[model samples]
Target: MLKRLFKLGLIINPYSGIGGALALKGSDGADIRQQALIRGAEKLSGKRMAIALQALLPLKNELSIYTASGEMGEDILSSMGFNHVVVYQHQAQQTESADTKAAALELIAQAVDLILFAGGDGTARNICEVVENHCPVVGVPAGCKIHSGVYAITPKAAGQVVAQVIKGELVSLMSGEVKDIDETEFRAGRVIAKHYGEMLVPEELRYIQAVKMGGKESDELVLSDIAAHVIELMDDEPDTLFVMGSGSTVDSIMQELGLSNTLLGVDLVRGQQLLANDLTAASLLEHCANKPVKIVLTLIGGQGHILGRGNQQLSPELVKMVSKQNILVVATKSKLQSLQGRPLVSDSGDTTLDEMLVGPIPVITGFHDLVLYSVGSM
Candidate 1:
């Protein structure tokens, strides 16, 4: 194969998902090497790095690489066969956020065409903090929850997008949702998502930008109207589940059903049984086993996020089992009008999950007209 001029930048946060894996309290803080060691696991940023490597390995000889130094920098590049230029090294606690900041800056300084990174929401925020809009960036989902638009749906999907970009394809660089989740709620077993900002996704990119849920805000949306519509749509099937995700709009549905809701937490109601209320991923998955479920959701206002913030209950794996087609969204017409041109957003923590829910899904508010929010809109 002829070599290509694809210049890429990458980074990894070693201590990301271990906390969830080891029952270590949380995804941040512990300071892995800086604080103390637990059970011989030296805090590996390897997971995220490995994902990015898989995306890039196919075109190793064709691209020039810039990366950070140390476990996050040298180890992955060496193992992947790319001779990368190390820009900065991170301390052990140096999670994806720190490394991403360093690598993005280096790529900007080097004026590389693209910066491909590996991490979740925190890492995405770190890059947004410093990324020059002129430099296009993409993310490889490797962290606990990657709700950033910059990431491809799957790590390998990111590689294919890069392949297209370098092949001189007419790719439109669209902004994907830069979403953040509240670490505070995470420990309490609640999902709380907030919009950090936006990132660019080269157009016609697949597996990177999921179907965006809600976007912007409109003065015209009436919560009551959206609620009424959802109530009418419920099949009222004997065993069919009506899992309402967090947000005011879904709350409207709950209100219509005469059931109390978390307002900002996941709620599950099936045939009026209220199977599980304000469920966490563990709880939802346990109970949802082998059952047909219908998720009645609402997109967050302004930032347009449908998941991630307060609905972490919907894990990427769980979402896959549910199938993308199973999701049902409810947003006020005014909210849809407010979207104007921004795509809906979902940071559900998992990039693949984000992709699954990132595009244009149907939004219901009233009887006749439906609102549409697309990943390309923003």
Candidate 2:
């Protein structure tokens, strides 16, 4: 059905997204991978690659893929019956970020038409370091916290983009930011994201996502209304443990309650008292044991995500302990509208929990103002 015979480059960060379900926050370097596995984390990026490659199968005869051996890319592409050449070989026992960089360098040396990689922001950074603006690239969203604009909205969307690229349908190239968060601070329930660099991504407005937004805004009237509503609810249940998530909107409620809250971390509040400040996953679990708990979260502006972005401290296990009904979501009208009517996303790393969070969820926008918004997997 397509006539173009392009040299496509494929690379996979086999250890990408491994730290997600384990609640390790960010998956970078070999030590993280080993720790993730010890904590029972499974391989996800390879399966994500399989999903994207399936979509490009129809172009098998017309595409020549250059990739690394084994889990990087060759295994999946070869099994899919696509013509591929192994450009790099990994050490097998130790595949680090250097392996990814080597693969990208070899792919660039081959002068591939397009490079497709499966990982989170870290993998994007590795590829961007070597192939910046030299060739078009697309990222498959398969990480714990994806703050990069290089990733597609979903893996299926990434597949669609890859197919279109092979068909020569997408012609625009736009710069996408590659960001990385401080893993040490992240595991401690503090979010510190920094922009590493940028990469050229195939521009298809439908598939690309926006970079994470930061900073604060003060809306005294509206924030006061939202804070009053939340305070009233907290007052009704004196014994319930309230887990507060980060963001300016949520911070407003904490300020009104006269309790200290983390501006970029998760905190625990119970009956007008600050029980914990910037609690880690293990610490939250330990404190919440045998206690009735509720989670209060705020949406990320522009990106409709209430979980799995910067609040990795509220791990999947901790969320399951609280359940969805006990979760409180509060956001401003402008923040909700910024999503353009899309449901909020949760990449909490636990697939079953993500599914359980699906369907229409209630969000408190203002004083007694409620909206039932759908929740989908990212």
Best by TM-score: 2
- What TM-score goes with each of the models? 0.49, 0.53
lDDT of each: 0.64, 0.79
Give me the runs in candidate 1 sitting further than 4 Å from their true place: 1-4, 24-26, 31-37, 40-45, 91-99, 203-378
Per-residue lDDT tens digits for candidate 1, residues 1-378, read 232345666666555555554554446554632333555544545655576467556667767787777765677788867878877766654445655666667777765657777666777788888883545667777666666677888776776776655543434456677887877687689888888777556645221221224543332345555566566555546576677888877776787678978887888887665666778888887877799877777777777777766777777777777765567777765565466555567776666666545333545655433433453211
Error of 1 at 182 (Å): 1.8
In the range 1-378, model 2's lDDT, one tens digit per residue, is 232256789999888889888777878767888888888888989899888888888888877889999999988887778888998999876578899999999998876767899998888878889998666688998888899999888888888887765654422345689998888888888999999888767644221111113423235766777788788887999999989998988999999988888999999998878988998989999999989998999888888888898899999999998977688888765676577756678888898888667644556665655544556544
RMSD values for the candidates in order, in angstroms, are 18.6, 20.1
The weakest ten consecutive residues by lDDT in model 1 span 204-213
Counting clashing residue pairs in each candidate, in order, gives 29, 0
lDDT at position 5, candidate 1:
46
